[model samples]
Target chain A: MRLRCLALILFSLSSSLARTQPDIANPHSEDTNWLNQYAHGLGEQHTELGLEALQLGDYAKAERSLLDAIQVIKVNQGLYATDQLRPLQYLIEAQLTLGEWHAAETQIEYFQWINVRNYRNSIFTYLNGTEALSGLLLASSANVNNPYSVRHLVAAKNLNWQAVNAIEQTFGSNSLELAPWLYRIVLNHYYQSTMLRRQGLSNYSFKSDSSEIVSGWTMRHNETLEMSYRIGKELLGRIQELFAYHVADHEQISNDATALMTIYQGDWELLFGNDEEALEHYRSAYQDLLQMGRSEAQVDRFFDRPVSLPAPRLQMQWPDQLAAESNEPLQFFAWSPMYPSASRPAEPRGDALAADDQQTALARFDLTPAAEDEPADTILADTNLSLDNLQILGTTPDNELTREQARVYISLLQFRPRLVSGMPVKLENIELEYLFPPQMSLLPLLDP
Target chain B: MIRSVGAYLKIRGTEMFKAIFALLSILLLHACVGSPAQSNAPRLPTDAEVEQYNASVPADEHIVCRDEIPVGTNIPRRKCRYVRDIQQTSTFHREQLRRALQ
Candidate 1:
């Protein structure tokens, strides 16, 4: 029995030694190149699997796969590797969709840390990272279930401001590169203004702290609105100045960019309820475009539709992107409860909108022109929408409440009136297809 | 007026000494007042520079740069401060308020 015990002990020792081979510190025992290649392959495989699972609505599986992918990438490339950002983003998306807010927040923090490190290394990489992070933050802010949606929106706006500062620093204050960033801030201002309107007056006295509830002085509602308006106007003006400089530097390339910016300025004014100023800007822009060699018909056709204020994307030029006139009903998708003006994310979060689950309301309204003698600042009073009929064309799990909710949302929208020959023209029988946000399909909608 | 030459010289010397004393007093006063305390701190950065520095640092260290109108001034000037400093200042004020209330 003693001989048997000695033999067993020897066997156990040998097994343990074999198991510790990797940690034995043999300089030539391992192939680092092979290990790195293997890790990269593994990370890529896991990432693809995670993305596929995300697409299939298997968020839990996606989260698992993406976490594994991030671990693999970190092990090979070391922490703060730019390679891990993609997987981190996917993981964040999965966590957000699964309503795992804390997990999502932690991942977002990690992603931001890695992004900032990259910023020090390469500016272009930093800008790309900012864009990705901004999109994620905006999406998070738009999530109806997110309790800290306002904080996310504010953070996103601050991020944009930082990006603007970086771009201005790197590419000069008057660089054309600053236009998009400035435009984004202006859009942020619009969203913030809307949020203020939604929240009312009670929450105005205190500011939100990251960890603890801290009471701090804040701008009153009207003051905050005024500030947003001023900031937005200033930013839009800066964008115009940048484009004007670009036009001058580029040998006056048609002045299309300047003209487009002017129209946007008008849209900004209209959004803030400065009707006379808005009209003046629109008319000036129309004439400017005409002076730039664009035919009257082309300019008129371009401004024919009643575009929603704070356009989803900034249009720097005209005619090149003029959509072909179509008989299809003009489609509008609700981006978020907080940000009515924001465009939908390129890759929408959560389950893809299935045909069976689609809720669409068809409405016909006469978009009236701004009255020539109307008061200049009729703030948010929708005098232009002459709703002839609002019919619920189609809805899944149809209910009266859904129809009513769609009607209310559609009514709240502010549209830039169609301009013809430098004059606002009334548009009649404009058929609009309003698509409700997917998350709000079955739930009762609240006034945004 | 045309007394002795030595006495004349003495008078001239006294006047000259008084003039020198006055000049030195002016110089001493100027030196004592100084040139408005020349700060050894580096020149404050422009809006863009602040942003560049902000981008390099972590979020807590990031600076908030904006145009601020000074009291009794119509013109707005760009002001930048670290977010951490702002938070600390705010917290300090809040604590003060709480203490006062208590």
Candidate 2:
């Protein structure tokens, strides 16, 4: 492996040198900068030595060598040149390990800006953040197919890496928090893959050329989903070792983890057309909500809520004495089960519930008000909006829909054109807060 | 002639006993060490076979156990004698069989 890396570095050096080799030997007489002239072959030399030192556990020497490489590369290639980023990464790590914060700060700053090319526009929205790691992260972000466009996966990915590094740097790799961070990294990759797929852009890379992963970053739908799912599956199992036995009392965290696993499993299965597994996930998610003391009606309401939680988290139950540690308690609801929903009856008795569902459906599109306040647009606004009656617009015919429902119908169409295309409409990131109206706060959480 | 034959029988009685013992040992070894069932193992019936067996059997008379299928027929038609499950595990279905037999 070391020899292969050496060969790769040498090949890169030769190629880079081939372009600038003539300029190095005969510093074009017009070139006034002595530093650029003398910097010939310095980057390659430093990189070679830095790698060797790194392999030999001479971090300080490796650090100096990589720092030299970064500077030489920056001088020969422009400061923001992609070639400089790799050496800068090595230098940053060396400084980090050597506790040279001031030095790493500069490297990270340059790395971060170059990762996004300091783009302040909307297109570069993904490339905002100043972590040196972002520079490394953005290495993969280059939408190689379009050299000019800023599909800056590098910045976001770098930020994720930086976050992970910081957490591990501070808390150590084995920290319980690291497990969730690992999950988040996988989540970020899936998001990127999904975004790419949505745009019909098949070509992508999740890592820089130098740090390419075994599974190439081609933005394949099943491959991306499978890769992320596999990682999530493995990480979730390992995370269970941290909290499984003690999670009984902290129903919310346990529920959240269970929900996360089921959602991952469910999404993966659904992606592969495994309806049974998807339904099983839905069933499990429903039970998880039920375990949170949410009744069937409440669970339905929970999913019906249109609010979005920005991130996934659950508040841990702490003893009254330790409650101060957990100031902001969150209850996370898994998103997958809400849409493409499969509802097992809240009560096992079948016909009456089906009758109620049919009646609800009949009234769902009715513009005629049940009371003075009810509007056709607000058909789904009720707390009794069970899974069976989840009538997202375009899912069913407008035969029963009064034209008054056009407002909501149009909005959904705008959100997902596929809704009207008669394709399956997938809902995601449904918040628990919107499911049950706040008025239901007075009701007790029902148990089976 | 009877006396001469009797004298010959008495002389060969020990040899006859030894020969009988050797034949029994050889038969025991073949039975224990080299049974044909080991090489030509019974195969399991697939879902289609089980469904076929279920359809072939009369509803009034319960379907034969997976092992008993195609066994008693004079024609010795080949069928999956090993009953594979149709809906769920065979064990669960076998419980149904147990209840039926009871």
- Candidate 2 lDDT over residue span B26-98, tens digit each: 9876755553345465654433223223332332221222222245643322333222222234556678899
lDDT of candidate 1 over A322-422, digit per residue (tens): 77777777878877655544446454644666767767677766566346554422222234433434555654456787777777777767777778787
Model 1: CAPRI class = incorrect
- Chain A only: list TM-scores of all candidates: 0.85, 0.35
Screening candidate 1 with a backbone cut-off below 3 angstroms (N, C-alpha, C), the clashing residue pairs are none
Q: Candidate 2 residues A1-448, lDDT tens each? A: 9999999999999998787666667764554355353376878888888877765657799898887787788777776676666676677655654556566657766776675554333212322333346433333232222231223453344355444555555556555555554544544454454444444444333222213332311335554444445544455444544444335643334545545455445544443345455545646765775676656654444333222211233223311232122212122221211111111112221231232222111112111123345433332211221112223332122443422232222121111001111112233222111111111212232211
Interface RMSD of predicted model 2? 24.6
Interface RMSD of each: 5.4, 24.6
What class would a CAPRI assessor give candidate 2's docking?
incorrect
Best by the DockQ measure = 1
Segments in model 1 whose C-alpha atoms lie over 4 Å from true places: A1-38, A201-206, A212-216, A251-254, A340-351, A369-398, B1-102
